[model samples]
Target chain A: MTTSDSSPTVRTPLYNLHVELGAKMVPFAGYDMPVSYPLGVLGEHNHTREKAGLFDVSHMGQAYLTGPDHDTCAAALEALVPGAVLTLGKGRIRYTQLLNSDGGIIDDLMVTRLVDDEDDGRLFLVVNAGCKHGDYAHIAAHLPAGIHLEPIEDRALVALQGPGAAEMFATICPEASEMGFMTAIRTDINGVDCWISRCGYTGEDGYEISVPEPQAEEFARLLLAHEAVEAIGLGARDSLRLESGLCLYGHDIDTTTSPVEADLMFSIAKRRREEGGFPGYGRVRSEIENGPKRIRVGIVPQTRAPAREGTEIQSNGETVGVITSGGFGPTYGGPIAMGYVSPEFSSPGCEVDLIVRGKTMPAKIAAMPFVEQRYYRKPKV
Target chain B: MSNIKYTEDHEYIRVDGDIATVGITDFAQSQLGDVVFVELPEVGASFEQGEDAAVVESVKAASEIYAPVSGEIVEVNTALEDEPTGVNSDPMGNGWFMKIKLSKASELDELMDEDAYKALVASQS
Candidate 1:
């Protein structure tokens, strides 16, 4: 859909900070966001790898879903997403996608069973910035009478991600030092009550802190005060997520693409696969048994030249697919990308060619997480 | 350090009779953000006025550099292969993209002066 001029585009609480930092701002997901800072996309990509990077993810949707009891709410959520919500222990989080009736991804989101303050049975949810409004509307419409979807529009999200992220957060929020990856807690940080999730999109050990909008600027400042945290923008965010094999909505996956076709079958639990009640269950089930015609795979360009979005993917001198995302991967030390390719050529180690500026450059289909994902997991007690 | 003439597309040309040293304007580099790679034309390659002569790629986008006037490429900045950032760091000096032997001497008259170029930038901004 075209981004309408009249559509209400919300700005993150840290919008001013981006302008102050001389960030090159552009419209993304209905928000004016900084694509990069003076360090530029390349330097910013490298900075996030070598040190901690502070990203203003405030534009991401933060919401809460509550039902009469934990069991009911968990089952209600599972009906919409593919995750086994009830099986999740308290303080644990799962990455799942909100799907349309056709079983196509509406948006990728995180859901955590929060420690109910009043025993009200609440589930903390975070969704993509671009799809937040539609996600909320879709969930609200599908939810039962007792189930309620509350949009926390006034909250701001910040992702402090990288190798140095854990240590940096530990200095400010000591309680979080013990938290493991995909685990979350409603904790106080420097006197501000916030929800801290030990998760990030950067393929690094990091935390996504959800703070009240009013306190966001100060919290960002506090994080930046640490030596390791450099301000990162959308440019690095895209590159980091791409390197991690995560899909970006509108570019990689959309309402037209199914989870199975997108190579996101890992997200669908076995129970859900068999029960087959979700929208487009038959289509998704068939694709699961019979592989999709084209699958998303990682492409590592043999040369330094980047094969950007829309560049054709060719095999045996014939166009098979197109690149959806690509750039210089600082961690990989060369150009890396993700694109759709015919199933016959989708296997890892498959050779392909990317038609970059009319020149066919040799590339290989590599297994994703081109770099190792460094999620922080607690040691076995 | 010579008097530079500017083109509407933001290229800058410094001419001394039949030879012209060419590079993108400071405005162009700033607009492109960070230069990462440059595809320079072969030294002996001949091009007509407004023909695609080179390519400059930044972190996010790429643009073609069109020759302001028909000319024969004499030299290209090989330094850009290793140090494309030089264009953002020093657009007019060591970052000079290429030098060309002008096929038409009076074509320089069609370019703009610094004042006119600055006015164009101001109006656009």
Candidate 2:
């Protein structure tokens, strides 16, 4: 594995805390992040699925787009991404992709519209750590002069995820339990100001708390003090997101992969699709109507051998696709993977071979989310 | 007790006459973190020293186990097929990966004793 020895690595606010907790540090996205703790990857993964896990996701990029009004700010952002940002409800969040001129994804991100009585337009955005600099530069270059893209460098993000997350957060801040999925609220947790969003990458009902840098460690410690919570590392974070079938920015959905081919068509709102004004509207619209040539799909090895990234996928001796994100799923008790394949071989149950270390391992195309998602959506009244 | 020797790659060999028991050390298992699968060479297969003789996979990645000395595989660890975590729990005992019939007993002279191997591990760390 690659070590953080080549360049000076950046540390998050919880760097000392991770070391005190016995985290094995590794280089990830230009940061010295913890890969796993003393519990090991398997134990940490299982614990997150069964209970609550606190993740220090401070390496992610956080920023805000501000303007005179919501329409101005939303329209400025809509020019870059294909999502219907103009109509995004107040206090609501939307998953979107920043696309290149050719309809290829630059980065996938989360955009949340905050509720403000003054109507001073502001939208919060969270981008991948590796692509943050590029994403910020792209936004600044394309947005109108009146609109400003402000990077929130003084804040840290932490995610409390898994089955018991809602209950644990409710104890500290009761209002958190009332927020529906894909919604955000500015709340105070034990007097620490935070922006808590009711969403996560783990396909579980959870909250992502954006807190000030100075109070980040203290806030994390408070939540970790709960009986159901354990401090998770990047190793388990990867497996949890894989089991949820969520794409990692650079790995699964990169500049070479279009949003449609990446199976993120739902992120394109109806109005945006009909209007077609986004950067890659021409290619994205065509792909939406005619379907993409290649699509992302889930793959499960028929054997115990795990097919890792860069492993070639084949069908009857012909190389068809390649594994992008793969590993052993602790919950599934087997090797699970996601990759891009030709449309002909993308259906669930289609058999293929994963070339691992010059050996062909049997695998089959399966419907994504090898694990069932349990996002909490408030029942309609 | 049988005479024990070590390889730089973190494998250990316990010799009793011409027969030898081979397995990875505790340090190797700890670095691997939770062994999930092990692929052993078939009995009767022969390999030269430093040749890839087996494969061990942890949750994170896979690694090849090299032969410490020229030998013919005599017995393979079948229990690892179902319980690979034994390699982590009892790396030197029940986790013994295989047994081999040494082609040349004199090969042990080139291997490290416990003291030298410990020094090497310390230096690497």
**Best of the candidates, TM-score:** 2
Q: Please list the residue runs of candidate 1 whose C-alpha ends up more than 4 Å from where it truly belongs after superposition.
A: A1-9, A117-120, B122-125
Worst 10 residues of 2 chain B by lDDT: B30-39
Interface RMSD of predicted model 1: 1.8
lDDT of candidate 1 at residue A156, scale 0 to 100:
91
lDDT score for residue A186 of model 2: 91
lDDT of 2 by residue, A266-367 (tens): 898888889988887888888889888889999999988888888999999999999999988889888899999998999999999999878899999999
Per-candidate count of clashing residue pairs (backbone under 3 Å) = 0, 0
DockQ of each: 0.50, 0.72
lDDT of 2 at A304: 83
Per-residue lDDT of model 2, residues B42-118, tens digit only? 99999998899999988888899988889999999999988999999999999999999999888999999999999
TM-score, prediction 2? 0.96
